[model samples]
Target: MSDFNSKHEKVAAKLRNEITGTEYEPGDQLPSEKRLCDYFKVSRVTVRHALQTLENERLIYRKQGLGAFVADTTLNSGLVQLTDFSEDMKKAGLKSSSGLISLDKVEPIKEVNEILQLRPDMKLIRIDRIRFANGNPVAFDITWLPPGYGQLLFDEDLTTQTIYDVLEDKYEIPIQGGSYRITAKNADDYIAKHLGIAPESAVLEIDRCSRTTGNKKVYFQKRYYNPSHVSYVLELSRNDNESMSSKDGLPLKEFSPSFAK
Candidate 1:
């Protein structure tokens, strides 16, 4: 590589480490470009290149005429992977936790009942929680599970453990796959309260149905994510014959047809 390229990359590497580490937290503004140039003994162009690299990685975002600020470093998930909240936070180098809102056995809504293939009289275990990343509220989740799987959670601590972990590890019920429907919605009063955002703020909503062996549904959950703290990346290939699939075990056939939208 040329000396110029090497210098810019070195600058970017240093900044990347600092942003990912405790040195710089989310929303922290980076040093001015002029200051960075002076400190690194590089030209303005080199510093700009470094900043551009970090921006492309989603580690930082630059404001026109203002400066670059660290991006929220939580819950950035690649759509191809099937990971829980804890796993996503870990991958982003953020601490993950949950605050249990309510856990109860109740009659589920009609939609949920149908999704779980339960009779009208059957009650489901409902778990409501606010998920946190580095102690910041990131998502409000409402999960409904069938009686058998739901009973397992009563003994486990929801604050420190995810339902996915509990079912897969303790009960040995592997979550084989899931179907997801993603959308954007304005936060209602209840969702806003739990997510600690303004009422009517935009949020990313995900309706997910996870299944175990033999395609038996395990849980149906609605997750409302704080947009500022979460982002999703979808990777696609150009080959027409290539089958598109989600690493998160989501079946593409479950996705809504283009004309249906």
Candidate 2:
């Protein structure tokens, strides 16, 4: 058993090297399991184990009928980092643009008001936008901010500039950190229209609350990503002091889908 494990690990290491070293580019199909077994002089089971390892690492994805292909890392973002949409697109070698849907001061729903911690009489500035990457719609975003910070955005060109950029550079309001809640949602008519996907298609939704200096909440945003255009990556270290039971672990709850009217 030990010898078999070692053999599979060796095979996986070699394939990982090739994939990372540019021998196999993104979206390139890998050799079949039989071919890999013949090349590595290993059993089919060993080859399968190696392929599974790569798939777990998100380095490759396998089709039901077709063989495994390298994953496009450009579409992946690290979950641990807090980056602006435009910044992320730029890093992926794509031009970022936004189509403003609406920007107005509105009465907040109970949930939005509670999340933003607004006063009773305070109206929220809401900004709705469709984010694009290389001219392709990738995400639909709705942002809610207190009147103070949000009104300032009214004067800026949201199509080309990110709220993060404006807040940090123009207003000198450094974004300290944020909390995120991620879930899988099915696109409704409104989301489908903005993202150019069929209604009922699966999408990745993230709810984020950002803060500024002195731990003051800045803004709350809901971003829905087209699964075909975006993927999230999270790296974990076993040596970290934060244990899964204490830091990373949260009580599991049933998911309920909500659709737009």
C-alpha positional error of residue 54 in candidate 2 after TM-score superposition, expressed in Å: 33
lDDT of 2: 0.80
Q: Residue 246 deviation, candidate 2, in Å? A: 9.4
Model 2, 105-198: lDDT tens per residue? 9996778878878776678999999998888898999999998899899988999888987876566565656888999999999999999999
Lowest lDDT 10-mer window, candidate 1?
252-261
Residue pairs in clash, model 1: 80-247, 81-248, 82-248
The reply for model 1, stretches above 4 Å from the true place, is 1-79, 240-261
lDDT of 1 by residue, 192-230 (tens): 999999999999999999987678999999999887877
What value does the lDDT take at residue 106 in candidate 1? 90
Model 1: lDDT to the true structure: 0.80
Q: Could you tell me every candidate's TM-score relative to the true structure?
A: 0.62, 0.62
